[model samples]
Target: MGYQFETEKVVDFILKNSVKKVLIQLPEGLKPYGVGLAKEIEEKAGVTAYVSADPCYGACDLPIQEAEILNVDLIIHYGHSEILKEAQKRIKILYVEAKSNLDIGKVVEKSLPFLKEYRNIGLVATVQHVHKLEEAKKILEKNGKKVFIGSASGLVKYDGQVLGCDCSTAEKIKDKVEVFLYIGGGIFHPLGVFYTTKKPVITVDPYTKKILNIKEIGEKFLKRRNTIIAKFSQAKNVGVLVGLKFGQSNPQLAEKICMKYLKMIRKKELEIILTKLQPNPNPKILLEQYSTPPEIAANLLYMATYSFNDIVGKTVCDLGCGSGRLAIGAAYLGAKEVVGIDLDLAAIQTAKTNSRMVGVKVEWVVGDIEVLTGKFDTVIQNPPFGVKKHGADLKFLRKALSLANTVYSIHKSGEKNRRFIEKTVTKNLCGRITTMVETNLVIPYLFNFHKKPKYRVKVDIYRIVKK
Candidate 1:
């Protein structure tokens, strides 16, 4: 009741976009207002609105597949700010943060009695009440207490805001503050703050006018976790459960857990692991988003890992890393750090999901090769063949050479093209082509112009070393 749903903005968006059918998704706390909002949309915008009964944890838990199944043109998701910017391209989602307008002076006054022992207090709140943190800070400072609010980073949108998973704001100011004052309703955020900072946390629920200390809850959670760990340590066999949800899926962590028990993994096994990775859902023609085949990726990584000894325990970068096959393969092959850079956000998102599915860690960036900077031990890339866009391969080669001493790049195979590439790398790029391996690149039907189910094009993989 204290939250603003922004009903007028939702109606205006629907009318402007000509969204005939829309789905309304709300958190459990905000579900009570769903029917009224839907009614308003139907009356004002003249659009059919259906309220989803499914529980939403955060902005990451988007019911995009459900919306797609219902064939809705747009989804109005309430109670959270937008976290998954990539998902918007798949389904049009409008996020209403549902900012609360409740006065917190009474709650802050109530919390002062419990805060008498502490001088320096760190202030934080959920996005709903993040705006009220200054008011709470003023209240605390007036009572002869120092208040500090951490600046925003990553998932934290506001200066004093904290997400259920991200309590960085509290952690950032934990050293300066003796205790944390969380101005939100639930123990979920406060618990995160307590665990992350290991500082005493006091929660002031503005709605209920209740005060709570979360140190005891955090202690109990730790005890439970340690007990589970103790039991798990005794077990000989353990099964990994992968979360299939967009927000819940964490295959990268699961992979790490599994790898802890494994001995030296072979190239064949790495290839098999990579084969299970999900391909880019949306590939652009201009970018030539042809994902490297599993066998080719494995072969390239094997050459770097086994033959050249460049990948293992070394930093690697994948230039124009489409769906992150090459970069992920390098990480799988024991690269200390792997970075995958791409211009397409959609491709980067798919690459992230694929890395999670394979249980490997890779720094995925949504940007062009020109944006990439830093030195790496090795660089691997499958750049455009200069077909749709002329001289695309030269751009990738030049960028790769600048980033790493050793570069493995793929280009269209031909006597004329190979000679041109060799001269370009040697003369202009200040690099020498050490080895050139001719391989067949299998291109599956992606664009509308493709005539066959699949076709093979001869391509040359050049291993260039900086002179």
Candidate 2:
């Protein structure tokens, strides 16, 4: 089936708005292509164009605050529809539809050589390309290979619609098959499949109609992380930092923190209130159902085990509290008062319920630790990590000394900036810092959703007191 887009209509819309600065949201699969199109449009239309490297999976999963900051007149968001209707007025969003035009038979034909003598093979692709799945399966099966079609749904926008960029279908049944074949246009389609499972991945590019062999497992891991980081850098104001959390779900703690601030203080508010929530306490039920992200356990344990004295009856803070675990632990240990802050409403909501359950009188404030203010006697928090959350450690450490006379921060151990932090603190705050503790947390079977084995995250605990 051949389809055509109204390019003139898009051009007319831009012309009507007198738009010069345009932001283009590329699809993950089509980012490299979209970048080219964006550059072409800029040259032809004589407009300033920005192509976001971070192609949204579906709708507006990525935050639009960065676009708003750019003062962009129009957003050329490709692959998905406009998920956020509110940003429509300030940001004119035009979603470009991206559908597969590859020859499935040719893709199947090209993949035969890599099959070797394997009898069982699995076929998968992103939701937009899933229509070719059965055809791919039939072709593989016809060649005397047992074929399995992965039944996992990618990120869904509304109902029954796949998120514009997800390979859940490939990831779900990757383990069952001996070889995985990715029949898509770009490396993005196969990269997800390769990461989630170790099955040898082969990608067939639709644009060129050729199959390319992928890298080995180790290289693929590093590639996936770099690809994700490249996408994340396009945003202006907002940043995501992930680390070891104490819970099962690998939720973006930094994102949850920013969302919390969005709720508490409207965007119109001038002075931003910066706060942190580190939820402590874990329900065995969640762990029983799913393994916790390795980083979570690593971070919380670092905060709990670090020894600091003379902090009793002093106001204390816990940033990115997952389930109020650290806050409750602080209160129990005799802090004058303790405030637990987190962006995850579920975590904060759970913390409140758990606080009552455990009979702890802890103040649970929901906000971003990065924007938190007001001085305190002591500030301690196991901020979200870099593995899952990216900006928390830097943000938390940067703001810690400003928040209290005595600052304690827990972050990934072995980071190169430990000495730099010591230097900055001594210079800025006129204080000397001391390393209090170092902890290592290794959790196996925690990342059921991850492609890698058990993760071991190192935690560094620093205790900073005034000179």
Which candidate leads in lDDT?
Answer: 1
Per-residue lDDT for 304-326 in model 1, tens only?
66556789999999988988889
Candidate 1 positional error at 76, Å: 1.0
For each candidate, what is the lDDT?
Answer: 0.86, 0.59
* Candidate 1 Cα misplacement greater than 4 A, ranges: 263-467
TM-score of model number 2: 0.39
lDDT of 2 by residue, 247-312 (tens): 112466667777854543121121111112323334232222122232333233223332234345
Superposition TM-score, candidate 1 onto the true structure: 0.56
RMSD per candidate (Å) reads 22.4, 19.3
- Badly placed stretches (over 4 Å) of model 2 are 1-22, 27-73, 80-92, 127-131, 150-154, 157-166, 174-176, 185-189, 208-215, 218-252, 255-467
